[model samples]
Target: MMTERSIREAKAGDKAFILWDSQIKGLGAKIFPGGEKSFVLSYRVNGAKRLSTIARVSELSLKAARERAGQELVRIRSGETDPLERRREAREAPTVNDLWDRFLTEYAPERITLGRMTTGTLKDYRNQAHRYLLPVLGRMKVRDVRRTDIERMARIMAHVPVQRNRTLAFASRLFTVAEHWSLRANYTNPCRGVVRAREEPRDRILSDSELAALGKTLTSLADRYPVPVNVIRFASVTGFRIMEAAGIQWSNINFERGCVTLPQTKVGRQVRALPPAALELLKSMPRINDCDFVFTTTGKVSVAYKHLDEVFKMVCQKARIENVRMHDLRRTVATTAAGQGVGLTVLRDLLGHKTVQMAVRYARQADSAVAAAVEQTGGNIASAMGVKPKAKIVHIRKRRHG
Candidate 1:
């Protein structure tokens, strides 16, 4: 008898009352003055009358709520059953939120995923859950959730496809943790068949002119924004992710070996060798006597995230570079290093990529070098076949200078 509007309007007075379903005998929705509505089934336990809540209004649709109430009524009428205790025991089943707590406390710390879970990963997870999962699936019992729920989450489109894919990935991992926790009613993960948004690999790299401009801008900002400039220069050569560079400590730097070691990294924690240029830049940076961090104003751990972002933005604006993020420096380093004939293994280690395939993905800005190699091969082939090499034809487009 509860329509959406009626349920919304339903309020309790000074006294409590159940608005029993007209069609169903004992099935009713209990309303409290506090505005909580729940589907409940009234049945007799032994000789005593007992009422057990089926589910919350938000958790189940009206039809599904009635159906659950009906099921509870039928179960009680059937010969030897304690419906109250059964539902009471069923109350112990964790909701998605509860399982999420357990996931953070138990599953994540053990590094159960494909790789090590960093603090940054946990922070991302916490933020993703805060923004996405808990808001959608908080009320649903973890066991009761079907594939459709996960599909619903995946369907939430973002302006960028990466955000949607990341939400899906976070959901998938939650389901995996739920499965490992053995909390799901169905053994299969809801995330398995759900189509996630495709993510394009970011290919932002600074050109020679842009790099020169950036260097000059950083040099100018050295007095005002000393920490970020040095860190930015360090990352340009070392390919350090913003967080990796942010987390750099004086103790991690091995000047003798010309390297910086990250005790904990996104992938496997490893040492990254610095070239003479990066080493010289590191040496040039003035160290604070009491501070342990390579980048800090308070001499605590590192510069505040917002401070780093603001300084970087200011530097970019000063450099006259449009649409350049801090991460592009890492990509620029990788592409430049690869073009300079740096080996894949060295790139993999230097960039802290878990695999060579990931390293290879970063080493993909060698079109000119590759074209030159192909030209040499073609010339050698033509000479062996006694064919004369054709004269090169070049086309140049004139730029409009302001």
Candidate 2:
């Protein structure tokens, strides 16, 4: 009599037709009907034998079948299991969206410690992530995301360069946080290695003709909106952001000293001296007893963001300028001063940049005045020689040349 154990082992490599049927041990392997290369294993699970595929002895070697059987035996002993069930559980786990929410709550507040972000900027980050990234990749496991996924996302976003670049940057930052926080085993920034779309430069400055048109538009806006006009004028002169100009208070200004002190900026607290034009504008506006803000919408300390949006857009349209943002007006201030021969270090301090490098961008826009100053004095020695400038040259030669 063939032993059951021997019969099971024989099923591994034997091509001969064999079959077994029993209740407890259940039905053993059998040649699949109408096929020689396929076999069925009728095995017991939870007191009932279920049939599962075990490839033909001719196709899958005896060693392979035994090895697979051993692995399946481990699963069969684990109470209840199915390949599809295992896969489904993996699919339902928390994903990139869950982590992004946690990260924004935990990381941003601490890292962005200088102060709160502007309401507009916060909304922008939220909308970009939600609208672009989360819908596609949010359900995928953060660990499962590979460089290829990032590259593909970037390629798809090639049409909208700036926003696309930002979305990729946000994804990169998210992975960085995951690595830093130990949520991931490896620190893989999917966005790190991939090439991104070239970010088009935005260094918009109003030309003289554009400024003339803008001035005309401002005249009309000033007639309709006094507080917004004051804010706009303040922005043009002082290089303060719209919110910063709106938030300015009487206590922050020292008119006698000709200075405006910002307790908080996008970067941090910064101090800027009031220019004569800004001073005159401030002087011309009637001081309101109801509110302390130098510029207010409705006797309140804050200016409505919407208050200036349309007016600024109207000015841009009237001027027929393209891609000119509000912050570009601030650039105009730095550009103006740089053209007036202001030193980079002085402009850095005037603009209240934390570092000199931030001010260096405007350093390039420095006009003829800087070059003129350089040409007016050939060298330091020219100033030293009051009557006649001297030309001096020194030369060096290597030993081989000599």
Candidate 3:
């Protein structure tokens, strides 16, 4: 047996040596010339000998060290595991930071090239990882991370429910990729079972009056910021996403076909039918020399996303529109189309959505339109039936005596 007194009183020699425990086979206390001490376990498996450090003397008492060594010895004898090899593998495991780097350099770009992921989504993932995931979990081994770790991150970001939910989604995606890459075990994703914060979907849409005001503001500012103003108009008329509108080239337009063909979008390739108003808007845009884009500030590239957003914000402020985003313009287009009796399938195509479910919300607006039409029909029928209207009773107050 290895006693605490023996371990404490053991003298350092000129060379490091282990004092084997008499009671527990293969368990020993290693004493180094530098006066350091640790408990080590030596064992053989399949005719091969290996040594694993159980713990430092300062970390475990003699009884604790004996129990650990006995457990490891039993596992080795049963041919179930090798303690040395397991420790070695753990030491070589990839950390979350490594997984993140691989995700960015391998998984994300590959998915982007395959059209399964969009650049905008990639930008958001990068932003969320840097702002939340990497700071806390980066140092942890990929396989060692638990659900509690992810839940802690979510709790830390609970104040911003939208951001917290997005971060959790991003972390979930990273771990899924890690499993695909064999860096983590399948079905062991730490993000699993972690509760995500509830997020409210944005449903803001610009009304007709607000749209008119916005158009007026754009016209007033067009002379000062032609490209951004035109870009906004294009997005509004086509119901295109902000990035989709900003990335459009002149070559994408077909005046004869009256459509624009996008080789890549959030949902992949799409051909959107352009109304005459949209075509006329495109026709009026002055093309810069040697510029391939429909909207450009330097003639070398399309208008930057940030600049377009800032210009839109300024235009909205001048138009006196409240609580409206540029994306609301896209919603407005969908709502207008739905109210005009456009079916769900056509709305899906118009919005370049992959599924008809994405266009289903606009069905409610169409239903409201139907209800108004029915109310009008009912009024006409009532008049035809000669239904008498209720007489109004006016209340009068008599003068008070002085």
Best by lDDT: 3
lDDT for each of the candidates? Answer: 0.79, 0.71, 0.88
Candidate 1 has a TM-score of 0.72
lDDT of 1 by residue, 177-267 (tens): 7887678744587777877665655677788899999989888888878887777787787788988888888889999988888877877
Badly placed stretches (over 4 Å) of model 2 are 1-93, 113-121, 249-251, 283-293, 298-301, 304-307, 319-323, 368-402
Per-residue accuracy of model 3 over 1-402 as CA lDDT, tens digit each: 568998999999999999999989999999999999999998888888888899999999999999999998888888876987787788989999998998888888899899999888999998998999989999999988999999888888989998998899889988988888888889898888887766666667787798899999999999999989998998899899988888888888899999988888878888888989889988998889879888888989888989998999999999999898888888888988998888999999999998999999877756666776786787789789997557643435455443
Model 2 residue 35 CA deviation in Å: 19
109-189, model 2: which lDDT tens digit per residue? 665564655444555678878888887788788777888887777777788988887888778877888888766666577
Alpha carbon deviation, residue 169, candidate 1 (Å) = 1.0
- The order of the candidates by TM-score, greatest first, is 3, 1, 2
Question: Model 3 misses residue 329 by how many Å?
Answer: 0.3
Q: 392, model 2: CA deviation in Å?
A: 34
For each candidate in turn, the TM-score is 0.72, 0.66, 0.87
**Against the true structure, candidate 3 has what lDDT?**
0.88
TM-score of 2: 0.66
Model 2 lDDT at residue 230: 75
Better by TM-score, candidate 3 or 2? 3
* Candidate 1 minimal-lDDT segment of 10 residues: 393-402
Best first by lDDT, ranked: 3, 1, 2
